[model samples]
Target: MWSALDLLSDPELCAGMSIVDISGDGLETLGSKRHHVVSLYYARKRAEQMGVTVNALVISDDGGDLARYYSKKVTIGSNSFVMNIKK
Candidate 1:
């Protein structure tokens, strides 16, 4: 998925000693923000090479509804590009 991919592509995320990726199925319920999601399928490979744990979780917005956007986050912190995949 692009979201995961974008997050991983971040230099800060790569700089992290560990990386976690989470994704969720499209909102099954209505009245939710429509989000086009992207993720990296090769996270396992990257983890193996980077010697980091490739953690993946199913994510949802508040109320467990559809999400609006896949965050493209990159910051100056040691670990970056972490999306809040919880309520």
Candidate 2:
């Protein structure tokens, strides 16, 4: 997500609005969960600083509150949002 934000934030793009769309199950199976959360926090901060909006599409396989998690930790910007698809 950070890399995508970096690419979209390129000065040459001359984009009026930069948006990063993320779709996932919201599961972190590898590495430390703490590290991942911290990384995501910083990445969100970076996106905010870069004037980029971050949105998320969450796939809820177990009827979990993944959309709430994403809304609190992932989505950013005034227009950013998280849409959950429950299975």
Candidate 3:
């Protein structure tokens, strides 16, 4: 698992600068599982602690309703923040 500090701070090897926000596109399409959702919530929580952001992007072919629904269901117990990326 990658941490916010890992993304925000300098890397051990490659000379790349910053990672900015950690994003996971298509996180849970079917909204059929919460395991990965919980993982993402924890990752975002850690990122918040490190003053970083986590972009959990889930795409929906159903005009974003599926994506929005997926986010809603996953964030229920977590109360994690989520946003829609309009195309």
Candidate 4:
């Protein structure tokens, strides 16, 4: 996310708006869930500070909980939203 943002931050780009679209299964299977959540929180903060919108497309299998989690912790900025694809 940071790398994408950094690339978009180039002065020559002159981007009027910056948005990050994230698509995932809404599962944190790598490391600590707590750490992942914290990292996402800070990433969202940074995106907000840069006036960037973060949106999510959540592929879920556990009812609507995954979408809710993403809406609460992942998506940020103006008109940001999460779209859930239930399995």
Candidate 5:
């Protein structure tokens, strides 16, 4: 992920762009806190490349044995609308 950010250090991706991190644990062991941490790092790196800001979004449920999740927010253009991420 850091490599991807480095590649996008140019001005294009950074223009009016934002990085967001979201976390939810429900599925297999793949769904872990470490994954969220990695996601956050990548998100921040991407945001820095775009000269924008990084927002860390998180949601969790202990009851989520294998079907729980949270989402991140993404806004675009001058209108600044939001889009929901599906898990």
Candidate 6:
């Protein structure tokens, strides 16, 4: 998550950016879910703090518990979107 913030710190890197890429993984464990939620929370917060308007490109296993949790918790903004892949 800090890596994402670091990228945003560079003007050239974040120029004209309108979206942030994130992953929701390994939701089978409590620890993973906590990490996912924390990362998403900070990512969203940092983007807002940077005065950037962005939607999340969330990738996860198709029909996965993590995907569902992410959609419910992170992608709450109307502009956000999600993708679920087979692998």
lDDT of each: 0.41, 0.81, 0.46, 0.80, 0.37, 0.57
Residue-level lDDT tens digits of model 1 in 18-71: 455545544233333645422243434454454444333336546432333323
On TM-score, the stronger of 1 and 4 is 4
Task: Compute each candidate's TM-score over C-alphas.
Answer: 0.29, 0.79, 0.40, 0.79, 0.27, 0.53
Report the lDDT tens digits of candidate 4 across residue range 1-87.
666677678887877669999888955444754453445657778888998999999998887998998898888987999999987
- What C-alpha RMSD separates each model from the true structure? 10.2, 3.3, 7.2, 3.5, 8.1, 4.8
Report the Cα lDDT for residue 34, model 6: 66
Candidate 2 runs further than 4 Å off: 28-38
TM-score for predicted model 6 compared with the true structure: 0.53
By lDDT, the candidates rank as: 2, 4, 6, 3, 1, 5
Which residue pairs overlap in candidate 3's backbone?
Answer: none
Worst 10 residues of 5 by lDDT: 68-77
lDDT of 5 at 74: 27
Clashes of 2: 0
Strongest candidate by lDDT:
2
Q: How many backbone clashes does candidate 6 have?
A: 0
Model 1, residue pairs in steric clash? 1-38, 1-39, 2-38, 2-39, 3-38
Of the two candidates 1 and 2, the one with more favorable TM-score, higher being better, is 2
Q: After superposition, how far is residue 72 of candidate 3 from its true place, in Å?
A: 6.4
Q: What is candidate 5's TM-score against the reference?
A: 0.27
Residue range 13-38, candidate 2, lDDT tens digits: 76666899998886534475445343
